[model samples]
Target: MTTRHDLQTRLERGIAALGLQLPAGAVERLLDYQALLARWNATYNLTAIRDPGEMVSRHLVDSLAILPYVQGATLADLGTGPGLPGIPIAIATPEREVLLVDSNGKKVRFLREAIRSLKLENVRAVQSRVEEVEGQFDCVTARAFASLADMLAWGGHLLTKSGIWLAMKGKHPEDELAGVPDGYEVRAIHELHVPDVGGERHLVVLGRTGC
Candidate 1:
């Protein structure tokens, strides 16, 4: 049985390995979010990963790894099932406004509950398809939600002209690079090193051409 203490230790270690300086109480808040997710996941099947330790590494730490690359004050997480990266980012940066968008009603419900329970003043959850979502953000994030081309086609309009799109992938998406739509270009590709997680992790940064 994984106690909350055990999960906290795992998360602390992972955060330390990532060299991240979270806000005071941020670590505990992250663990609280994970615990909430674990409980809800049992009934709603929000995520596939079942192990608590794995959740700390794969979900919490993996999401935080991109914190350094995250830019802008406003962000929209598209297809954010159960608020992966979005919720965690909101918790880490309380000042940044985070919008979590997902088409799944259940997931959005979970997100709302999370927001209420976590006291996340900077986060909001909406149940809507990416294409239907309104308003632009300074930064947009999509985690393994779709192919690069499809994601851009659906949610590209949400990114400001000078904003960036951070796409998380398991491995370097070399083949998908060619499919990037015109007027958008790859700014940089970073190989993220997520602590205690196996397999390759890559963050593909995209933005408007010449921006």
Candidate 2:
């Protein structure tokens, strides 16, 4: 088993390579959060990706890829299973309020426990469908939850009139872009470079053009 210290070292290295200017003690908190996730994943199977090192790359780094594109003071991560992107963003950007939305009860339980254990004051895990989630946020994010059109259709209401949505994908979603609804437009598809990981990773930035 990889010791916690070893995982911390790898995470620190990965964070440094990623060039993220995290808040004080954010790294430690992230490690703690990862530990909790691993513990819960053993039986609950929160995520498919195992291995602490890979978690640092796939989970931590993949989530951090949107840091540069994050807009505004509040963000809602729709279909945020196990608090990907949202939880890490909350730990890194303590100023931004992050809400993780997912309908899965087990996942929500894990998210709540993670929030409590990490002592993250800025993150809240809500058990609700994306379409039913209330409030408009400055930014919204989802990870391959559904088609771009479907994603916007269901969660678009959560985004402010001029807010942005950063959708994480493993490859460029050309097919998904064909039907991006009416009010939303593709601003730019950013190709993310996550350290210690290979293959394609992109953050599709979708901005609302109308109210």
Task: Give the winner by TM-score.
Answer: 1
- Tens digits of per-residue lDDT, candidate 2, 1-211, equal 8887887888777777778788889888888888888889999999998898788778887788688789899999999999988998889899999999999999999999998878888889999989899999999999878889899989989988889999899889988888999878999998888888899988889987853
Worst 10 residues of 1 by lDDT: 9-18
Positional deviation of 29 in candidate 1, in angstroms? 0.7
lDDT value for model 2:
0.88
Per-residue lDDT of candidate 1, residues 29-127 (tens digit)? 999999999999999999999899999999999999999989999999999998988998999999999999999999999999999999999999999
Which portions of model 1 show Cα errors greater than 4 Å?
none
Error of 1 at 116 (Å): 0.4
TM-score of model 2 vs. true structure: 0.96
Clashing pairs for model 2 are none
